[model samples]
Every structure is written in C-alpha cells, then in structure tokens.
Target: MNITVFCSAYSLDDRYSVPAAEFARLLGSGGHTLVWGGSNAGLMGLLADEVKAAGGRLVGVLVELLAHKGYQGADELVMTADLAARKAELLARADAVVVLAGGLGTLDEVTEVVELRKHGLHDKPIVLLDTEGFYAGLRTQLERMEAEGFLPRPLAELVSFAGTPAEVFELLAAAS
Candidate 1:
C-alpha cells in the first residue's frame, strides 16, 4: 500500500517521534511504500529514514518553497507550484492516509482529506494515530461535529483510530 503520512516537520517530543518511527518500520518491513511531505526533519525525517533503511519506497510531494530547505529523503520527488498542488498530488497517489502527531500543517492536510471523503470524492481510509492520546481533542471535536449534524456521515465511517503502529498496519490492510 502507498500510505500518505501527515505529521509534524519540527516537533522534538519523543512521545510523537518514537511511535512515528516504529510505524514507519512496520510499514517498511511490511512492504508498504510511504508517500509524504518531503522534509528530512522531525517526524517526517524519522519516518523516511526508517522506511528507507527497511527497504520500502519513498515518494515525496513537496512545494517549491520547502524543497529548497534541503535533506529531502524520497526515491522520487514531485515538486509542485504550491501547497495545494502538493497536497493534491499526495492524495492522488495514496491508498490510505495515516495522520501522526503534528501541528497546524498536519491538521490542514487531514481536514482536507476528510472533507474530500465526506463529499464522496474518494473512499480511501484515513487513520488517526493517536499517539499518547495526542489526538483526543481533535477526536472530541469530530464527535461534536457529528452530534451537531454538520458532518455528512458518522465519524467512524470516515476515519479509523489506532493507538499503535501494529493496529495502523491492520487498519491499512483491512482498508486495502
């Protein structure tokens, strides 16, 4: 599977980095490819390094601005004119999406994907890796949206929650 991972580009928290690397190892050893932001920093770098070391393919979609930062670890790098185009390319090739602990950028990516799914644009499964309960607040917000009838469908129908990397692989396998 080609799994697109949305995660932080600069978070020093081991609570997030450790699990993200483990998940990458799992994905790599399982013969899955990683599709993500092409940054060799923070969780993005950790995951990319693990995947490469484990012999899994890495595909990176980067905007022109960020690509200039250097140290991008992707077998194939796809450069886009802007962030929107970068995201579109990322989603276009992904079989599934796994959102790890991240900040505003990650939130933006996940929300856009969810909106696409809600509008029936795609049926790809989106998994939230709630490492250390990091996504608790977001989960609550999603629930509130569902309760308020703002969501087109139940939250469960749109996203899957996995607390561990093993569970993430299982969800991805099941999604495929």
Candidate 2:
C-alpha cells in the first residue's frame, strides 16, 4: 500500500512523536510505502526516518516554496507548483490516507481528501490516528454534520478513527 500520511512539519512533543514513529514502523515492516509531504523538518522527517529504518519506501510530494526543506533520502520526490497542487498529487499517489496529530496544513490535507471522497471523486479509505484523543473535537463536529444533514453521505463512510497505530492498519486492511 502507498499510505499517504499527513503530519506536522514542526517538532512535536513525545506524546505525538512516539505514536507517529510506531505507525511509521508498522507501515515500513508491513512492506508498504509512505507517500507524504517531502519535508525533513520535524514530525514528517521523523516518520520518513523510522519508515526507512524499518525498510519502507518513501515518496514525497512537495510544494516548490518548501523545496528547501525537502527530505534528502526519499525513494522518489515530486515537486508541485503550489499547496493545492501538492495536495492533489499526494492524494493521486496514495492507496490510502492516514492523518497523525498535526497543525493547520495537515488538517487542510485531510479535509480536502474527505470532501473529495464524500463527493465520490475517490473511494480511498481515510483514517485518523487519534492519538490522545487529539481528534475528539473534529469527530464531534463531523458527527454533527452527519446529524444535521450537512454531509451528503454518512460521516463514518467517509472517514474512520483509530486510537492506535495497529488499529489504523487494521481499519485499512478491513477497508480494502
């Protein structure tokens, strides 16, 4: 599987980093590839490192503006003209999407993918690794959207939540 991961470009606390690393290890040892933002800055870099250490392939989709921060050892790197194009390419290359605890950029990536799935543009399975209940509020808001008919499809069908790295893979496997 070419698992596209959305995560922070800034350094994060162990509370977030530890689980993210575990997830990376799992992805690699499972003989999967990582498709992600091509940044060697923080959490993203850590994920690439762990995944590579565990023998996974890395494919990075990067925006031209952040080219200076690109990962040096990705198995393949793709450059996009802008953020929108970068997001598109990331989704284009992924078999599935996994979101880890991150900031605005990560949130934006996940939202666009879910919106696309809801619209039937794609049928990829989207999973959020809700480490430490990091996504509780987002889950609540999405449930409300489903309850209020704001979404065209059931929220659960568009996305699923997993509490651990193992659960993320299990959900992905089940979805496939």
Candidate 3:
C-alpha cells in the first residue's frame, strides 16, 4: 500500500522519533511504500531514512518553500507550488493515510484528510498512531463531536486508532 504518513517535521522528543523509525522499518519490511512531507528533519527524516535503509520506496511531496530545506533521499520527489497543492498531491497518491505524533502542521494534514473522507471525497482507510497518548485529546474530541451529532457518521467509521506500529499494520491488513 502507498501509506501517506502525516508527522512532525521537527520534534525533540525521542518518544515520537523512536516509533516513527520503527513504523518505517515495518513499512519497508512489509514492502509498503511511504508518502510523506519531504524534509530531512524530525520524525519525517527519521522515518524516511529507516524506510530507505530497509529497502522501501519513498515518495516525498514538498512545496517550493519547503523544498529548499532539504529532503531525506526519497526515491521519488514531487514539488508543489504551495502547502495546499502539496496536501492535494499527497491525498491524490495515497491508498491510506497514517497520522503519527506531530504538531500543528500534522494536525492540519490529518484533519483535512478526515474532513475530506467525511464529505465523501474518498473512502481510504485513515489510521491514527497514537504513540504515547499523543492523540488522546484529538480522539476524545472526535468522539465528542460524534456524540453531539456534529458528525454525519461516527468517527470510528472513518478513523482507526493503533497504539503501536504493529497494530497499525494489523489495521491496514484488515482494511485491505
């Protein structure tokens, strides 16, 4: 599967970085491709490096502004005009989307994908890798939205949560 991973471009926490590499390793070993922001920093870089070392295909989508920052040696690099275009391209090429521990940018990407799915733009599986409870608040908020009838359907129908990389793969296998 072409798994689009939304994660932080920068993080000081090993808690996030360690699992990011493990997830990449698993993806590579499983023969899955990785699609992510093209940057040689933080979890994004770590994941891409691990995937490449493990012999997996890496596809990076970055905007012109971000492209100058440097890439983590993606086998295929796609440059976009801006962030919106980058997001569009990422979504267009993904068979599935994975949300990892990240900050504001990651949140934006994940939320946009979820909203797109909600609006029937696509039916791709979206998995949240809640490493170290990073996404607990977001999960709770999603549930609250469903309980209040703000969502057209239950969030669970659109998103799956996995505490570990192994569980993420399990969910992906079942989804496939």
Ranking by TM-score: 2, 3, 1
Give Cα distance to truth, residue 126, candidate 1, Å.
Answer: 0.2
Checking candidate 1 for backbone clashes, the offending pairs are none
In angstroms, give how far residue 9 of model 3 lies from its true place: 0.6
Clashes of each: 0, 0, 0
Q: Model 3, 1-176: lDDT tens per residue?
A: 89999998885577888888889999998898999998888888888899998989999998888877657478889999989999999999999999998889999999999999999999999999999999999999999999999999788878999999999999988998
Q: How far is candidate 1 from the true structure (C-alpha RMSD, Å)?
A: 1.1
* Candidate 2 C-alpha lDDT tens digits along 22-133: 9999999999999999999999999999999999999999999999999999999999999999999999999999999999999999999999999999999999999999
lDDT of 2: 0.96
TM-score to native of every candidate shown: 0.96, 0.99, 0.97
Best by the TM-score measure: 2
Error of 1 at 135 (Å): 0.7
Best by the lDDT measure? 2
| Candidate 1, position 144, lDDT | 98
Q: lDDT (CA) for every model shown?
A: 0.89, 0.96, 0.90
Q: Is candidate 1 or candidate 2 better by lDDT?
A: 2
